[model samples]
Target: MTPLPIAAPLTIAIDGPAAAGKGTLAKRLAAHYGLPYLDTGLLYRAVGRLADEQGVDLDDAEAAGAVARALDAGAIDEAALRGREAGELASRVAAHPPVRAALEAFQRAFAADPRGAVLDGRDIGTVICPGARVKIFVTASAEVRARRRTDELAAKGRTVEYERILAEVRERDARDAGRAAAPLKPAADARLLDTSELDIETAFRAACAIVDQAPH
Candidate 1:
C-alpha cells in the first residue's frame, strides 16, 4: 500500500507594531509548518515605491488605487523596501481606502494558497486574514521596539538614532491604529505574544504552541 498524503489548512495570521518581532516569528512558524510565508506590508511598500517613481501623490486615492491594482505581488523586492522613507510613503498610501481595497484581493488570494501560508503585518489578524486558523498578535513596548529597530538598522550601516526611530514607531503606531480602514488591531479571539520581555526564540516557541493547539 502507498502512503497517504496529509493536508492541513493552517493559516497563521500575525499582527503587531513595527519591530515587535512578529515578522521574524512568522518566518519561524512558517518554516516549522512547512508553509509559504508572506510579509504583507511589503505589498504596500511595493506600491508606495512605485508611486514615488511615478511622482504620484501617495494621498491621491484614485492614482494610488490605480497604481496598486496595476502592480503585482511577485514584483516586490523585500531588500529594496527596507527604509524609513519608503515606509512613510507606504503608510500614506495605505491610508487610502481605494488603495487598501486594491491590495485586499491579492492578500486574500495568497492566504488561500493550497500549501497554506503565514502572513505577518500590522493588520493580518484583524483584517487581512481574520479567519486564519491561528492568530497571534505580537507586540512590545515602544522603547523596546525602537531598540530592536535601531540595532537592525545599525547592522546594515544605516546608523539612525534610537530616539528618532522611537518617535517614528510611535507615529506609525498611531497612524496604523487610528486609520479608518482595517486598523492595526488584533482579532478578539487572537492570542497576544508580547516580545518586550521575550527573545525571538521564546516568541517563536509561543507562536508554535499557539499553532499546535489550533483545531485543524
Candidate 2:
C-alpha cells in the first residue's frame, strides 16, 4: 500500500491513464479511510450519455455544455455509462472546456467535505485539487493496459479485438494528453505508481503506504 502523510482528514487525488488501476485503488483507499470516492470519469461519461440520448452532436460544444450543466448526479447509471456509444461521446465531450468547468463544482464540493475523499481521473491532482496533500499518479505501459483491458472484457463476455482496443487506448491517451483543459499529467508533487505488474491488492497497499507516510 502507498503510505499517506495526512495527519487528519484530507483529500487524496489519484490521477492516471486509462486502465492504470487508479479507479480501483481510489475506491479501496476511500473504503479503508471511510471516505467518499469520486470517479470523475463517470461525470464525463454521464454527460456524454445524456448528449447521445438527446441527439446532441458530440462535436457541438454548446450543446455538450448545456447537457453538462443540467446533469443530475443521481441519474448516472454505471452500466449505461459504459456503453461504446457513451464512451466515444465522453471522449468527445471531455474535450470541451465548458463541460469540464460545469462539472468542476460537483467534484470540488465532494472533495471539500469534512470526510476525506478520494478522486481519480486524468487531472484530479492538477485541476480538481491542487492543494491535495496526497497525490498519486498511477500508470502502466500502454501495451500492458491494453492487455489487461482486453482480458477484462473477455472475462465479462464482451467481444473485443485486442488490436482494436489497443488502438482506441492509444487514441484516448493522445486526446486526453492533448486537451487544453486539465490534460492528463502528473502534478510535480504527486508520487508515481507504475503498476504494470502489480495486482489491485498490491497497488492498494502501496498507495496506502504513500498516504500513511504523507504529512497531513
Off by over 4 Å in 1: 1-8
Model 2 has an lDDT value of 0.89
Candidate 1 per-residue C-alpha lDDT over 53-166 given as tens digits, one digit per residue, 9 for 90 to 100: 999987789999999999978777899997777888888888888999998888888899877899988777777888888899999999998898889889988869999999
* Clashes found in each candidate (C-alpha, N, C closer than 3 A): 0, 26
lDDT by residue (1-216, candidate 2, tens digit) is 998764666789999988899988999999998888989989999998889889998888888999999999887888777644566678889999989999999999988988778999888899999989799999999999989989988998999999998898899899989988788899999999999999888998999999998986
| Per-residue lDDT of 198 in model 2 | 94
State TM-scores per candidate: 0.93, 0.93
Task: For candidate 1, give the lDDT of residue 191.
Answer: 94
Ten contiguous residues with the weakest lDDT in model 1: 2-11
